[model samples]
Target: MSESILSISDNSEVILHFDLKLSDGSAVDSTRVNKKPAKMVMGDGSLTKNFEDCLRGLGAGDKKTFEISANEAFGMPNPDNIYHIDRSKFAADTELSDGMIMGFSQPDGSELPGIIRAVAGQSVTVDFNHPLAGQDVIFDVEIIEVR
Candidate 1:
């Protein structure tokens, strides 16, 4: 039987160090800061299909680096994601600081997370788009071990 390193077969565990960066070379996230490896099972939806596809055919102790565009990463931003709300919706104690994340509950009991983008008289603009939306990113992966 031929065995593969990062195959998504049953009973396989994958551990690796990952770094995410922008096209400008600015680091977005890296496992190096925490000095910890991220472990996951193959075929799990935790990672996007494009990312998982890159892990195929790798064995333990194997390391690889690849880059994915914004479409494959956080995806392109949608204009419909922007919304404006009345300032009264927020409490007086609420600090309307830009770049702050806040959660709003829908009538169906689902929660939507939005970032405070701007504040104006009696109105606040919130954006529910992903922070990295519309920007290309690079992902570096180092496969530590696979079982």
Candidate 2:
């Protein structure tokens, strides 16, 4: 008797390698480049629903590519995530520059990463949106194991 293959489904533990790229074909991230494969559980809150949908029904050794929209990937940027803070809030020695990423503390003691959008003499504009927000992306995936 032949053994049945395990495919990705809800609650399945998956190990895979993936490369993320912008729609223009610029590389953004890659597990293969990092020399580590990514492992995750399906239906975990970590993955976007659309991204999980693309992984469904795939067995080990499956190789595929998927294109996801901005809304489906990192999501569209929310204007409310932008904040302007007084320059005095930062340490005097901290060099503020456009496109710098800084971690800010939240009331719950968690850290939120914010990107510096603008730095004025008295005010600094920070955007809390994910860096890839508002951009469509492509994902190249190789399923290594599913259990």
Candidate 3:
């Protein structure tokens, strides 16, 4: 009998190799670096609904590559998400660097990530949008084995 592709109800384990890249052909993440496989349940929310839809019927030893737009991938970046904060909030010894991801707590006791944009006297500009928010991404997937 031929191997069956993974389905929503399949409880078999699966190992997959994946590479995430930006529209500019820059590598964001890849499983090859650590030489390890990533496994996850089919119906779990670990992967986005759209991403999971693409893998609905792939069998073991199958390799597939696909691209997802900004909206489907990481969603469009919102300009309103950017904010400016007083420089004093940062400690004097703290070093400010562009493109650094920092976490800030909100009044609701939730923490949000922001990127350091710029720094001026007594003022710090930060962007809370995700780094890949506005960019399309490509996903390379290889299904090693599916139980």
Candidate 4:
């Protein structure tokens, strides 16, 4: 008797390594950075629907690279996500600059990161959009095992 391979489906546990890159070929994120592969169950809200869709029919040892549109990946940035906070809200001795990422506490007791856009006189412009929110990306995945 021959053994059948398991394909990825809803609730299937998947272990894989992936490289996320910008459309221009710049690296965004990779699971191999620390030699740790990502493990997750499909439809567990850990991955976007589009991303899971790409792996639906793949089984163990499958290698594939696919492109994901910005809308399907992180989605487009929303202007409402940007906010201007009074400089007084920060510490008196705090120094602010453009391109700095700072964590802000949310009402739910979680920290949300925002990027500094500008430090105008008495107001600080912060953008809360995901850094890669507006860009398309390429996903290179190597499926290690599926169960």
Residues 1-147, candidate 1: write the lDDT tens digits. Answer: 886445444446788888889988899999888999889877777677777777777766666777788888888989899999999989988999889999989899999889999999988999999888888878888888887
lDDT of 2: 0.95
- What TM-score would every model get versus the actual structure? 0.83, 0.96, 0.84, 0.94
Clashing pairs in 2: none
Best candidate, TM-score-wise? 2
Clashing residue pairs for model 1: 5-58, 5-59, 6-58
- Candidate 3 C-alpha lDDT tens digits along 23-92: 7889999989999988988666677777777766777777888899999988898989988889889888
Clashes in candidate 3: how many?
Answer: 0
- What does candidate 2 score on TM? 0.96
Q: Per-residue lDDT for 51-123 in model 2, tens only?
A: 9999999999999999999999999999999999999999999999999998999999999999999997899
RMSD, model 1, all Cα superposed? Answer: 2.8
Better of 3 and 4 by TM-score: 4
lDDT of 4 by residue, 1-147 (tens): 988999999899999999999999999899999999999999999888999999998999999999999999989999999999999999999889999998999999999999999998999999999988999999999999999
Candidate 4 local lDDT, residue 105? 95
Of candidates 4 and 3, the better by lDDT: 4
lDDT of 4: 0.95
Off by over 4 Å in 1: 1-12, 106-111
C-alpha lDDT of residue 80 in model 4: 100
